[model samples]
Target: MRYKGFVIFTLFLFNIITIKPKAIDEKDSLYIDNCKRDLLVLMMAYSDEIRDIEVSEDNYIYLVLNNNKKIIYDDKKEKNKNAKILDADIQDTLEDIYPLDSINSVLEGMDPGRGRSYTFLNSIYGGNQNEIEKNLDFFSTYCGNIMFNKKAKAGEALKNALNEAKELADKDNRVNNYIFPISGSYNYRVIQDTGRLSPHAYGIAIDLNRNDSDYWKWVDKSKGSKRIEEYPKELVKVFENNGFIWGGKWEHFDILHFEYRPEIILKSKFFGDTSKSNNKKWYEGAPLNDEIENIINIINSKL
Candidate 1:
């Protein structure tokens, strides 16, 4: 992946100068900008699987998969917070911005990366339990041996993260206490009290050593915050660097939970909060290469 040099490039319109907004209003401008950003990151993170993007005859946007499937960009529906999670489109799934920087306190009523697009997940990982199981393999993590989906480099990323964590454990005994006896990974079950399939169902989430205060519903925010404070920041850094989002960062915190979500990480790492951006191009900070340049060209041309 050209991701090794992630110093992003900016796209100019047909002219070298900046172009005017194509949307009807400022609100629409922001919406379209977000769609473009999300689509860009998805293609970057899943470069091999998410083959291309499309704009329907009616102007609706879609992400076309290698299997020739199309997932909608935004349904433009009026949805309550609960509705967003229960029935998420690609737009709803990435609506909440994940914080890449280390945060000591749990988010308030915001669970980024919690509401997932099953269509997107299934497209890249697997369609069902049986298909997912075919891709599962046991990898030796420093925490313990656990099953992970071999697809999309999920298993490889997990092993790499833990390998670095194990190296950190050598100097800091505290790190060992926190990660040793990893709770589990690769359980094909739905999330508690939800109809949606968990990332674990696709063998992409891992739980580190558990603590009673690690869960939100089990305890309370006070306890969750305390656990978050005591938690080792370096350990969290290692996981994030390897493309996992910590559930501990969520309001509905699951401290032990770390799921592989490279698109989310890449989005935050590159094009964060476009409103604050002063760049001439939407993908301002992204690194460029033949592959990334090609993807950017497709988005620029199609969108």
Candidate 2:
């Protein structure tokens, strides 16, 4: 009986020593997992433009574009929110997770998808004003002539979103007030009080009918919060479902603004919910097929 007991204990101890912990935090921890997640999301989001990823000797990751241009994933710099908005890395831009569910109140100190990565933008979209203008095609909406980028289907997405919104307006008269009289789109202008080019400058953002209480700068938090709640949820939903992020959800709320940011939306859709504790793979919830599986393999092996 003592011999048997000793063998059993030895086996148990060996098993405990040999069994590996799950790769829950593979590289660094949640940070590495998040980096991989963001990279994969970007891959799935812009599959047409992003060709492959490059890992450097010093351990820098880059998104290799079809045009042979490479954009760094993270500079490993420490920057405040304002600094990030001005000059942001892909990491910094995607750090703030945008909530998909409707919000009656404003987000505090976080504007997911608000910070513009000019390096990434200029790579996918046009670089200079002239180059960007060349990619522009005037899109006709109830908001009048709004110019949108032809590259990356920015124009098509905007058209589809507005067309759906128009159908919604047809059924619900209340939606019309918010859909019509769009403020502007495709203006090659810097944001007021800042040198950063507006998302509108990229022809990816559309501003709906103006309200004095629509913007954070224009009104206090009380009024902005009221405007958000008062705004038609369906209208916002329509835009979001069509690959847009609502400015009303931002800390620096621009209630009338909706920008086409598929990467942000993809992350929200695929990795938003934390209830999937049963997931064996990190990329479990995302739609899987040939290309995505291939990307997943590459990410797992590389990252």
- The number of clashing residue pairs in each candidate reads 5, 0
Q: To one decimal, what is the Cα RMSD in angstroms of model 2 from the true structure?
A: 5.5
lDDT of 2 by residue, 169-243 (tens): 989899888876778888999998987889888888888889899999998998899988889898888888878
lDDT of 2: 0.85
* Residue ranges of candidate 1 with Cα displaced over 4 Å: 1-23
Q: TM-score for every candidate vs. truth?
A: 0.89, 0.87
The per-residue C-alpha lDDT of model 2 at residue 150 equals 77
The model with the greatest TM-score is: 1
RMSD of each: 11.1, 5.5
**Model 1 residue 42 lDDT?**
87
lDDT of 1 by residue, 1-303 (tens): 465334333343332344444334566767777788889888988877788899988888888888898888787789999888787888887778788888887889889888888888888888988899999998986566779999888999999999999988998989988897888888888888877788989999998889999998899899899999999999999999999999998988999999999988888788766658553577777788888888888888987
Residue 267 miss distance in model 2 (angstroms): 0.1
The parts of candidate 2 lying over 4 Å away from their true place are 1-27, 142-145, 274-279
Question: Which pairs clash (backbone N, Cα, C closer than 3 Å) in model 2?
Answer: none
Tell me model 1's lDDT, rounded to 2 decimals: 0.85
For model 1, the run of ten residues with the poorest summed lDDT: 7-16
